[model samples]
Target: MAKTRTDLINQVLDRLNILVYGQSPSLEDVQRADRIVDGAIAKLASLDIYYVQDPGQAGPSGGAIEDEAFLPLADYIASFHLLADARTQALAQIAEAELRTIAAPARTLRTLRVDPALTPRRYGYYRGGI
Candidate 1:
């Protein structure tokens, strides 16, 4: 089953220890987390490493990323946004590193060609037999 935005927000809140068992987060906090998740998605889209689709709608009830691997990335980013402490920052960094490993950038191979006419022969050798 695909996870929803609420799941992502809850995961982030859990990571930040903002939402504990038997307690629900406030509506304002939930909205804040939703925005944070959107920002995280935007950040990933900006990297161009992955193709992220629009969340379609806005709010915690909106759709979520299908890629399970990217879920943690969103969680870490949202957690950092909720709590920009050194630890959260480090976790975010680690998440990014893991993302790079999961989806390494594509490398294009390039070829170099040299035209004989453009190439210079020996120092004393002339092109026109001069």
Candidate 2:
């Protein structure tokens, strides 16, 4: 018999926690992910250097939009390898609300970021720090 969604989530979270000591979440697990992503966002502050191919050359052109894109780009970069979107940061919160009625919840969720431009498909993920 095929396993339910609940079974699948349990499996994924279990697998994820191998590095995390097997899935019974601690402040440390969630805190670490949060810190890592925050650092990723901070790293993006220097991304202008990446676009600057030549020492004195101009960068990707788009007028006002280029300057405007920084925050969203930073957000997108941070989320490339992150878990949970900005919308629903806490699985526990979802459990208390949405999942309370349902028997199972989804764990293998897409990374979360705000600003529509930050959506994974828009900026393209770099996997490990571009």
Q: Give the top-scoring candidate (lDDT).
A: 1
Q: Write the per-residue lDDT of candidate 2 for residues 27-128, one digit (tens) a residue.
A: 454344434433433443353222311111112112121332332332333333346455433432332333223323467788866996765675666789
Error of 2 at 28 (Å): 1.3
Poorly placed runs, candidate 1 (over 4 Å) = 54-56, 79-82, 105-130
- Determine which window of 10 residues in candidate 1 has minimal summed lDDT: 49-58
**lDDT (Cα, 0-100) at 38 in candidate 2:** 34
Tens-digit per-residue lDDT, 42-113, candidate 1? 767788645445453556666645665555566456544636677777777777766766676556676778
- Runs in model 2 deviating more than 4 A are 1-24, 49-130
Q: Relative to the unseen true structure, what is the Cα RMSD of model 1?
A: 8.8
Error of 2 at 59 (Å): 36
Once model 2 is optimally superposed onto the true structure by TM-score, how far is the C-alpha of residue 125 displaced, in angstroms? 56
